[model samples]
Target: MRVVRGREFVADRAWGAEDIASMNGVSTRLHWTDQPYKWHVNDGEEVFVVLDGKVEMFFRENGEEASVTLGVGDIFYASVGTEHVAHPVGEARILVVEKEGSV
Candidate 1:
């Protein structure tokens, strides 16, 4: 079993990325905080789990911009080619899991 302390993980500057497929279809936890006014697009589907604080997920659908606020324990999934931005309301800790061979 893999265990992580959220507080310490957040305090660290460099976080390592791991492959879940090597771990037998398991999910790995990740802590991330992006800069304000920045945006990202994923080539594949991804699930974001809010562990602490809040995050606003911004997206555009049908030429209209939309947003949703996600708090602790809230989860959101984004599909491939989805354009969006995430803004942390406070210091946010999130767990990112990629399914095996998903990419």
Candidate 2:
């Protein structure tokens, strides 16, 4: 069991993360970042959830780039082979669920 005051959480630096859980090959983590993540495709599916603050999610589909703004409570699903990146709108807290070792 774990308890976190998510809204009050802050990262040590850009892209800092707190491990939440890992079971049956799936892992869950809470991340804090003020900078942007590098664009990359996951080896498997991924679930991106915003717990606090705001974020801009950028993705490439069919060689065309697109983006979306995500606020608290928003969820982004990344399927296999989907290339995407995340840019925090200041400082943001995010929850990520993905296969172990998938970045």
Candidate 3:
């Protein structure tokens, strides 16, 4: 089992970006503040596990905008090639996991 503390993970951006290799997959935690970040579309699918605070995930499809609110323990999946933006409603910490060689 892999265990990580949100407070410790948030302390260093480099540490948060460190690659975790396991039989299941590679995982990384991304920490965000209240500032909004740009949307992104990657080649790999991703599962975002909300560890603290709240976040808004916005996506656009067929010229329509869709969004959802996620809080602690909430998991959000970003499909491969799906364009989306994520912003914290407050201070937030999220663990992002993706398959190796997928990103």
Whole-model lDDT per candidate: 0.66, 0.93, 0.70
Candidate 1 per-residue lDDT, tens place, 8-96, comes to 45534422333222455635556656434356666567788888778888987677889999998999887776677777786777777
lDDT tens digits, residue span 1-103, model 2 = 7798877777788888888899999999899899999999998999999999999999999999999999999999999999999999999999999999987
All models, RMSD in angstroms = 3.7, 0.8, 3.1
Best by TM-score: 2
Which scores better on lDDT, 1 or 3?
Answer: 3
Task: Give the alpha carbon lDDT tens digit for every residue of 13-80 in model 3.
Answer: 32134354445656454554555567777668888877887889898877788999998999989877
lDDT-superior candidate, 1 or 2: 2
TM-score of candidate 3 relative to the true fold: 0.74
TM-score per model over all chains: 0.72, 0.96, 0.74
Candidate 2: worst 10 consecutive residues by lDDT? 1-10
Clashing pairs in 2: none
